[model samples]
Target: MRAFSGSRLAELCLVLLACWLCPGSALAETRVALVVGNGAYTSTAQLPNPSHDAEDVAASLKRSGFEVLQGINLRQAEMQDLTIRFARAASRADVAMFYYSGHAMQYNGVNYLMPIDAMLTDEADLKRFVRVDDIVNDLQQAKNLRILVLDSCRDNPLAETLKRSAGATRAASIGRGLSKVEAPRGTIVSFSTQSGQVAADGTGRNSPYTTAFLKHIEQPHEIGDVFRDISSDVYDSSGKTQLPELSLSIIGKFYLNGQVAMTVAPTAPQAAPQPDPCAAAEAHWKAAESIGNVSAFEDHLARFSSCSFANLAKARIEGLKQKTVLAPAADGARASGTKAFDGNYWDVTLNCPASGKAQGFTRALAATVTNGVFHAEGQNPGGSNRLEIDGQIPADGKTTLSARGTTGASAYTLNNLAPGSPYAFTIDAQFERSRGSGKRNEARACNLVFVKR
Candidate 1:
C-alpha cells in the first residue's frame, strides 16, 4: 500500500496547494486512510454493509495512499479505542477519511452508535454505549483534510428501547445536517443516506450502498462526482432503498487522486537538551479531567520518541483537541470540603492508553481529603468504587483529585462522607474510545471514570 509517513504529510500539503493553482496533474504523496466495517453484533442485528464496505474501501484506500484500520463485531469501548488510534494516524496525514457501516439510532435527539454487544434496553444506557457525535467529531478534529463517510442509515434497532424509556413517538430521528455548525476550513462530510431516511438492504449479498460505494470510490472522480454516482447507483440498484446526503462547505480541492500539501515551520538555532518533552507535557495532559483536549495530546505526542503511551496518548490528545468541546485543563480548583460522587461517570476525550492495561482499568482512585487529612481507598482492579469520606464534604468545595496512568480503570461511588470534612473531591476522569465502525479494536476495553460518594 502507498504510505505517507507523518514526517512527510507537512511537506506534501504545500505542494498540493500549489499544484491546485496550476492546471495539470501534480504528483505528490497524500496520506490517506480507510476505517471500515462493523459486523458481528451479539444481540443486535448483524450489519452486512460494514464487512462488505470495508473490503473494497481498504483496497481503494491503499491505492489512494491511505492506511486502514479495520474492526468487526466491536463493543462501544473497543470501537472508540480504534477510532482514537486512527486519529493519531491522521495527525501527519494530508487527507483523512473515516467510513463506517454499522447500526445507529437517535433518542431524544441524541445519536448513538450501536455496538455489537449493546444492550440498549433503556434510555439511561446511552452513557454505557456509544455516542454518534463523539465518533464524527473526533474524526473531524484531524488537523488537515477531513472527510467523513457514514454508511449507517439502517432502520433504527432500538425502537423498542426508545419507546419504552424515552416515551418518544419514535426511536430516534436521524437528524439532518452536520452539528448545526460549520467545521474547520478543510473538511467534508458524506452520509450514505439523508438524515432521517433509511437505506435499503440488497436483494443479493451486498447492500445497495456498499455496491455503489465500491463502484465509484476507485475511479478518477472528484469527491462530489463520486457521491453523485453513489447516490444514483443506490437508487437504481436497491429499488431506491437508500438516499444519501452530503453536508459540506469545503472551499478547497480534494482529489482521490494523489494530491499533497506541505508547509515548513520557522526554525531557530538548535537548543541543548530540551528536557523530556513528555514530562513537560504531563502538566497539560493532566490538566483537564474532561475529554476532547486534542491539542495538548498532539503537542505531547509529536515530541516523544517512541514512548509506551505514545500511540494512545497521542490519539486521546488529538481527539479532544479536534473536537469542539470544553475539555480544557481544570482551571477552577475543587471547592474545599467533603464532596460526594453520584456513581461512575467519565471525562473521556480519547482512547485509553495501552499502558492503561498495566495501570489497571480504573479511571480514578477514591480518596478522602478533609481538614488536612488524605487517604486512598477502594483499590480494586476493575471493580466498583465505593470510597466514602468520614463526613459530608463542605459545600464550599474546592480542590480536585488527579489520577494518571493509562492502565487504571476504576468504578467509584462516593457518598456518606463526614459531615464537616473540609475538602472533598474526585478526579473527573476523561475516557477515550476509538471508533470501531466494523474495524478492529472493537473488543478493546473502553476507558472508564470511576466515582463514589
Candidate 2:
C-alpha cells in the first residue's frame, strides 16, 4: 500500500476509532442538514462570507455523515421550497440542523431571515422574508436533536429604511441583529453574537463565527463542549469583540464524531445549574437598552424589580416618555422669536376618569420644550396604548396640543372603542412659568397637569 500522509493517517485513525467504539453506529443514525447562504442582495449591500461559509460547512457535515441540502444566493421562493423539503427530510432524521448566513433582523419581537432578492423598504414587506419561528417549528420535527446556527448578524442597511416607514410605536420595536429566543426542548439555537449586538464578517473566506465553528465541530467532544470551545475561539480571535451565544435545552450527551461509548456505566442525569440572577438581569437590561422604548424598559422592570438595574430602568422609562411628539406648530408661530417656555421640563400627568363603558387610567409623562417646540410621547406599559403630543409654544404660552394614537384594550378607551382603532383629540390649555393645566372636553372627562420639573 502507498504510504499515507500525516493528515491522511490522522483521518484514518479517527475512522478506525469510531468503528472500534461503536460498530454500525454510523449507518444506524440518520442526520440531515439545511444550509443556505444568501449574498448578492439586490437592494442592499452584499455580504462576502455567507456563500463560502455555507459551502465549507456543508462539506464538513457531509464528511460527518449528514445528508446536506445546500443552497447559495437563494431568493425568497427558492428558500421556502428548500425549507419545505428540509422539513420533510428532518421528520425522518435522528439529528437535524439548519444553518443560514446572510442578513437577519428582529421586529416586534419576531426575528426574520432575509433572502437575496428582498427589498424591505416598508414594515409590511417583512411578510416576504422568512420568519425564524417558522423554521424553528419545522426543525422541531426531528426525533432527537435539532440545531440552528445563524451567522447572519452583520450590520443591515435595510433596517433603517424599515424603521423610517414604520409607525413610531412599531419603529421602537425594531432591533439590531436577532432577539434572544427560547430554545425548544431537545434543541439548541446559536447566534454569531449576543442578542442585539452585531457580528463581524471575517477578513477570511468565512465569517468569524462560522470559521470558529468549523474548527471544533469535528472533534470527538460532546456537543456542549464543542460550542463552548467555539465561543472561546471567537472571543479570542475577534479581538474580544464578537462573543458567540447559544440557548440550549438539550438533554443527555451527544458527540458529533459518533464517539458514544464510555468506559464506565452511565449514571442518572444531573440537573443543570441555575444561572446567576444579576447576570441574567444585566442581560435583560442590555436588550432593553438596545430597543430604547418605554415598553421594553417597563418589561425589564416587571421581571427584575429588585435587580441592580431597577433604578436605571425607571430612568430610561422617564427619558423615553419625554421623547414623544405633539402636533406641529403653525407657520406664523414657527417664524416667531424664542418663546417663553423655550427651555423647560414639564411633569405631565394624564388622568382619565371612569365613564360609561370605559375604564379609568392614569399616566405620568415627562415632557420638554426646546427652542419653542413641545414634543412628548407616552405609552401604557405592557399594552398597545400610545399617546403622541407635538406643537410649538408661542410667546403667549398658549396653544392647543393635539394628541393621536391607537387604542389598546376595549375597556380602556372612550366608548369602548375596539383595540387598534385610531383616535385623535386635542388638549386646550395655557402654560405659566412653573405650572400649567389642560382639559379635554370630549365625551369622557380627561385632565392633564403640568408642573415644572
Candidate 3:
C-alpha cells in the first residue's frame, strides 16, 4: 500500500475514533447550543465583557459541531423568546447546551438570571426577570444529554440599592450570587463560582472562568475532565479565589471531541467484572464525614443512590436536620435544666421483628442523636436499612416517641408511643406495617438502643 501522508493518517484516526465512540448513530444525532450574553444594561452600570464572552463562546461551539443560537444585550421578553426557541431546537437534538454570561442573583432561594433591561428595584420586579428554574424545567423535556454553563455570578451593585429602597421584606430575599441547583438526570450544570460566591468579570473581554473553559473545551477529552481542567485553570488564574462548581448527573460517558476511550483486554475472567459503585460512594462519604454538613451527605446520595451507603447518607442528612431543629430552641433559651443534644456519635442497635409477610431486620449501626431524635443506618442482608426515631418532650412532662424504619421493600412506622429516654426508644405494636399497593395493614414493632461514643 502507498504511504499515507501525516495529515491523512490523522484524519483516518479521528474517523476511527468517531466510529468507536458513536457506534452506528453519530450522524443521526444533532447537537444544539444556545448562548446569551447580557452586558448593556440601561438601569445599572453596563457590563462590558459578557457580550464579547457570549460571541466567542458561540463561535467556539459552532466550530465544535453545534448549531449555535447566539444573542446579546437581550431584554426580558427577548430572553424568554430565545429560551423557547432554544428549547424547541433542543427537543430534536441529541445534546443541548445553554451558555449564559450576565448578572444573576438569588432572592428567597429562587435564582433569577438578569436581562439587560432589568431594574430589580423591588421584590415584585422579580416577575420581570427570567427564573433559572423555568429554563431548566423547559430543557428537561429534551431527549438526551443537557449541559448548562452559567457565568452569571457577578455581584450586583443594584442589589444594595434595591435593598435600601425597598424594605426588609425584599432585602432579606436579595442575596449575593446564585443559589445551588439540583440538576435533573442526564444533565450537567456548571457555575462560574461556588454557590453564594461572586465571580470576577476579568479585566479582559471575558470572565476568568469562561476564559479557562474556552481554552480547554475544544480539547479531545471527556466532558467531566474538561470541567475539571476548567476548575483547575480558573483557580490558578484567579489566585485560588474563584473556584468553579459543578452539578453532574450524566448517565453515560461523553467526549467533547468524540475521542474513543482506551480499553485494555482483561487478563482474567474476574478482571472483567463491573466496577463496584460502593467503593467510590464510601470514599466520598468518608470525605464528607469530615466536612459534616447536610450538603456533603446529600451530594453522596445524589451521585450514588443505589450504592450500599445510601441509607447511611440519608440518615446522616436527617441527623443534621434534627440538630438544626433543636439548635434554634437552645439559641432562644429553652427551659432551664434542659440539656442540649450531645454532639458525640452513637452506636445503634435496632430490632425489627418479622410479622405479616415482612421479614425480620436486625443490625448494628452508627449515628448521631440530637435532642429526642435519633437517625441511624446499617447494612443488612438485602441492602442498607435506616431507622429514624423522633420524640417530642412536651412541657406537661408527658413524652411521646414516633419511630420509622425501612429496609428494601419493608417499612415500619410506629405512631405515638410512650418512649422511655432520649437515648433509646422502642416500638412494640400489636400489628405489622402495611405492604403492597393497597390493603389494610398494621405496623410492626422495632427496638432501637443508642450508645454514645
Candidate 4:
C-alpha cells in the first residue's frame, strides 16, 4: 500500500472518529418492511394484480436498503405468523412499513384484510381476517417512522353474502370499501382510493395504485411528496374515478430513497375537529331506517328531536307499532284453529363433526311451533355463543330454517375460527307434529335432530 500524505491521513482519522462516535453513521439505518399480496382466493374470483404488486414493491424496497418480508397468496395462518415475525423485527428498526394488496373490506366500520384462503361467508368470518388496525399497531413500535399502504379497494365479492346473512340492520354497517382511518402520530396510512369507493385492478401487471406508487417511490423525494405524486397519477390515469387518499401524521420529512437524511422533530398535536350535528343526525337516521324497528326509531327521535329527520322517525315509530299490534292479532287468529305443526314442542340437538384443524362439538336447544312458525333461541352457559333458529313450516312440513349466531371457543370451531365470529347457515328440515330432522347446508358437516319434549 502506498503511504498517505499527512493531510489525507488526518482527514481519514477524523472520519474514523466520527464513525466510532456514531455507529450508525458508518452503516445504513435499519429499515424493515412487510409486503403481502393475496390473489388466489379460494372462495371468490382471483385478483389479477396483487401478486405482481407485492413482488414489485418488495424488489423496490430491497433496492432502497430495506429488509423486506414478502408474501404472496398467503393463507390466514401463514399471514398471522408472518405478521407476528414482522412486528418483532419492526421493533428494532428505524423505519418500518407494511404494504398489502388483496381483498379487504369494512364491516361495522372496522377494516379487514383478507387472506387468499379466506372464505368470508358472513360478518363473523372477519375474525379469521386481519384487521388493518393490527398492522398499524405493529408499525407503531418502530423507532422513527411508520408507513402503511393498502391497495385493497377492489370490489369485494364477499360483501353480498355477508349482507344477506347479517340481516338488514347489521347489513347497513357493512360499507362498500375500506373505512377511513386516522393515523397515529409519526405514522402515515395510505389507501388505494377514497373511503367507501372502489378501485380498479389494472389490466397490466399491477394495480393502478401500485403502478403509480412504484413509479415515484424511488424518485429521490420526501415520502409525503412521493405519495402525493402517486395519488395524482392514479387519479389522472383512472379517469378521475380512483382518488388515492392518505392519513398522515408524520411530524417531519422522511425520505424513502436514502438520498436525504431523515429529519423528525417534535410537534404539538392538532385538535380534533368537532363533529357536525346535522351530519351526526343524518347518520343516526340512516341507522334507524336500516333497523326499521320501533325502538330504533324512538332512540333516534330522542337524540335528534328537532333535526330534519325527526318527523320521519316519528312516522316510522307509529308504523312499527301498528305492525306490532296487527302481527299479534294475526297470530292469535291462526292459533285459535290449531294448524298441523302448531303447539308442537321439540328438543333440538346439533351435532358437528370434526374437520381439518377444527374440533367438533354438540349443542342442545328447545323450540316450539306457534301458528305454523318455528322459533328457538339457545345460549351456551356462561359463554359468548348464542344461536337463533326461525322459519315458517308450510303445510307440506318441509322448509328451510335459518340459523345464525356468534361463535365460541376457537378449538370447537371450524378452522379454529376466532371466538365471537358470526356464522349463518340454512338447515333443510322435514318435520312431523312431534319429530324433525335437518342437515346444515354449508361447508361444514352438521346435522340437527328434534324430538317431542
Better of 1 and 2 by TM-score: 2
Please give the lDDT score for candidate 4: 0.79
Q: Number of backbone collisions per candidate, in order? A: 90, 6, 4, 1
lDDT score, candidate 2, position 426: 62
What is candidate 2's lDDT per residue for 416-451, written digit by digit as tens?
555755555567667887677776533345778878
lDDT, model 4, position 70: 93
Error of 3 at 226 (Å): 1.2
Model 3: which ten-residue window has the lowest total lDDT?
431-440
Which residue ranges in model 1 land beyond 4 Å of their true spot? 1-27, 30-34, 168-184, 258-453
The TM-score, computed over Cα atoms with residue i paired to residue i, of candidate 1 is 0.48
Better of 1 and 3 by lDDT: 3
Identify the candidate with maximal lDDT.
4
lDDT digits (tens) for residues 57-114 of candidate 4: 9999888778899999999999999999999999999899999998998875568999
TM-score for each of the candidates: 0.48, 0.57, 0.59, 0.55
Please write out the lDDT profile of model 3 over residues 256-325, one tens digit for every residue: 5765654443576654568766547645855675456799899988998886456556666876899899
